[model samples]
Target: MMEAANCSLRVNRLLLDPKFESYKLSLDPLPCYGVELDTAVAEVKLRDDQYTLDHMRAYGMYNYLHCNPWSPDSVFYVDQLGRVMNINVTLDTALGKPIEVFRFPSDLSSCDRRLCSSIHFTSQDWVTLSDGTGTLYLIHILRNDQSAAGKWELKFNQELGDPFIVLHSVLYTRSEVQIIDALILSIEKDELDVEGSGFHVSLEWISITCSPNDDKYEILKRRNLHGKSVPHYAAIEPDGNSLTIISYKPFRFIADETNQPEEERMEEEEKKGKEVRELFKMTFALPEGAGRAVLSSGSVEVTLAKREVGNMWAEVIAGDTQGEFVADPAQSAAIAERLMHLTSEDLNPNPDCEKPPCNAQELEECDMSLEDSTTLCRFDGNTTKATHVVNLGGNQFLFSLEAAPELMPCFSLRHDVDALMWQPVSSQGDNLWDHAATFNALGYVQASKQDKKFFTCAPNFSYAALCECVRRIFIYRQPTPVSTVLYNRKEGRHVGQVAKQQVASLESSDPILGFQASNERLFVLTTKKLFVIRVNTAG
Candidate 1:
């Protein structure tokens, strides 16, 4: 157990000693969510020059603790030797011996275990790995399975898109367990083609018509818009065998809008070259889809999606208003069935949901004027669409940054400092997919003084761990009484709070590489040691 630290706050002139275990949330006097120092540490050292930081960093991206399906209680991780290590924190105090799961003469000579970087294409077992030489291999790994290939079996091998691509959401046929419908964006180059001073961008969508189980995937290159800039918010939609792009001229929130009058602002805006919010939607007949893995690839000016969403038409100018003409046949049967069902119900007036009158105060009246306000951010969306959303999901979500310190929303901006945010393309569609909305900052992570820290959250999200220097990790404990009302809150939502130099630090010898959080422990890997930090919230 860790001891409590004293925090001084000038609110209501009261002296309070918060155990630093939880936070008292209210904007005016938001409790400082402090840290718990090193109460316990045990050395579970590793073999020399075997499982280095590179292997740990690779495992950090594909942290399997959150996707433990084979063994509920045991945590699974891999080492440089291709050994699948399983650790049950409850049953064992330290990590046991390595369990060799690969087989020799497995027909995967080129994709050797030591040379390849293993990444899970799906949350479960299907892994499409790379040897970092632009070669991908399909492997089915199951530690507890009793199959022909046993734990590590190379199913099929093929040379696909860029090897250093991120992939997930494995697609399987509903009829049979066949892998199909995955999108691989193998970007040949990270930079746009520049002719002297011009930058050209291109996005190509190609769909595989057959199963990857046979392993004959194809690739096609799309055309590039040379010397032309893609419009803001432009996105591509994929149909059966083609692609569609939707874009618009945005009305960006001008930074110096405060200096212009409302009437003058409207008049000046009209003088611009193009009208604000100009809609542009078109189709590109490029194919889409992959076999199993949706590799982390291209997401720049172009976006690939299924259908058109978030398109708002002001008025319906033409037919289908009366609903007399049934144009499409596949929907006629479904439409008739729906009309028959609704025809039976009595005049179904909407239920009463009257909210109380606003008190005319700024807080209360602002609620009335919130015609376009939201509480949920993209990361907080339920199905997709939510406000600062009544304090994010039911379960605590952990967020990891490649090199931590550069990106935490940061603690505060006392008029002099600014905060930063890193938005990935995955959140663009999977989360809210708000094309028109500007990015919002609901919560924040207290940025460490050092900027190169590797960040990963605890399994339970009870706290967060960051490694900046060698052998030392700073701990940020999650504030308690998670509140949605940011009306003066000090800490960031979902981000654990820790002031500069006022948090717990775990020491080690070698450079700290990566971290994997489990229920009761956080597995900290160094150059040659695997240190376990026990997580406890109570003081």
Candidate 2:
């Protein structure tokens, strides 16, 4: 282990035993799996204060290649005959144990070997298997079944008609036993009909939901997005209420046209093509809780953290790519008509107005005559260019806009009675704050702040801490403030700030990949290693 000065944390380097030094390690539960002496071997060894080997087993011929994310005791691999098998690591019998989970049908016997048999355990209870023929099955593990000890039951299957490929699948679970929802991202072939050869891609989003008391899984929603591009990564909020998708192309939304008459809609549809011309950053606002889910383009990663204000917050601190506008004059005119129709409908019933009410069509014609511009609203200044917008639950939102190349403008939005309200956050000025790191009950370390640190404590006291990511590890310190205020005129006296001492720095060699904090520990994952740091509070 390497040590640094003035850091409060300790570092420990873990090495595998000599016999299993060459094996690749799966850090899920600290297990290592690889070939040894021409035999497949799986072992778990962890050392903190002393060295200890937890479990070791060897398979004579059959290889237990991949580890399952759902459970630590299970591993799977495709057999020679294209059959996917799951092996239990705890089965210590001389014969060893393997169970046949799935096999392709005889009709699909000549399916492509490379893609025919791929299985993923998305959650503790849900597993997805594909037949390489555009069919996917969701398997739910019945743990309480008495007839068969570890039985796997098929819940449902979805067929994404010909020429559609499943790019990513994510399962959201509330606990070890309950799966709340699942999201599947797929790409379908467009005009270019040759099965695998196509430059035009139509992206689709499929959402599946299963209640806690029900055993059936149902498709809640499915939408063929307007924009065509490849998505890089996807994430679901902690509450399982929203999903954010990251793609390589600009995001577009399908306009809501439910209120239009069938004839008018059909006539307008004939004039407008299947795709929309105006391009915007991809973001989705689900009806429930009025949550805004932003799907940004590119490889930039977004970080989510809980706030003390009783809502969840997400911060994205990456560079943005300018989107293109490709609308022709005819397309612009058509869009303008639609926008005018929508605005007229919104003002048809005004309870505050005492004048005679006008019909939607009349109002639309009158409004169109007064203005040449079709756009209903527009933002002009640099502060109006939003980089990130977070849904703070209950129709409340926070937007981080770009003020300068390096400065950010912060504001909050909420509904005040019948009208909407936008208020700027005074605490966040033009200073360079870390948008990726968040504060919670545990603590947060930012390198940009002068004091360099902050932490939350019981009875309402908050302290500050700051650190720099020189290497992978953080060298942090708690600075002495020139003046500390403990009282608020309106809220009365507050809890006093805690004074932290100088300690040794936390050190690592690899680049930090991700960080997560719980009530007691901080888990940091680097490109090459994993570091589990203990959280200690000063009294």
- In model 1, which runs have C-alpha deviations exceeding 4 angstroms? 1-92, 103-116, 142-150, 174-177, 180-445, 480-507, 536-539
How far residue 117's Cα lies from its native spot in candidate 2, in Å, is 4.2
Residue-level lDDT of model 1, residues 135-180, one tens digit each, is 5456666557643223656665555444432232233343443432
- Superposed by TM-score, candidate 2 places the C-alpha of residue 439 at a distance from the truth, in angstroms, of 21
lDDT, residue 192, candidate 1? 38
Task: Compute the lDDT for candidate 2.
Answer: 0.35
Worst 10 residues of 1 by lDDT: 409-418
Clash totals in order: 13, 11
- Tens digit of per-residue lDDT, candidate 2, span 1-539: 01111111111112111111111111222111211111112211111311111101011111123334334334455454545555443322221345566554434445342222345455556666655456766777767754222567777777765323343345654454334333343333345445633433344445666553566677765544432344323333323443333333333323335632334455567756643343223333345434234423323332333223222223323454443334458867977987984576564577787756755565422122211211111111122121332222222221221111111222112221111112222134322122221122111122122322211111111211222232322322222232566554565655343333323234554333233222222333333333344333323
TM-scores of the candidates in the order shown: 0.40, 0.34
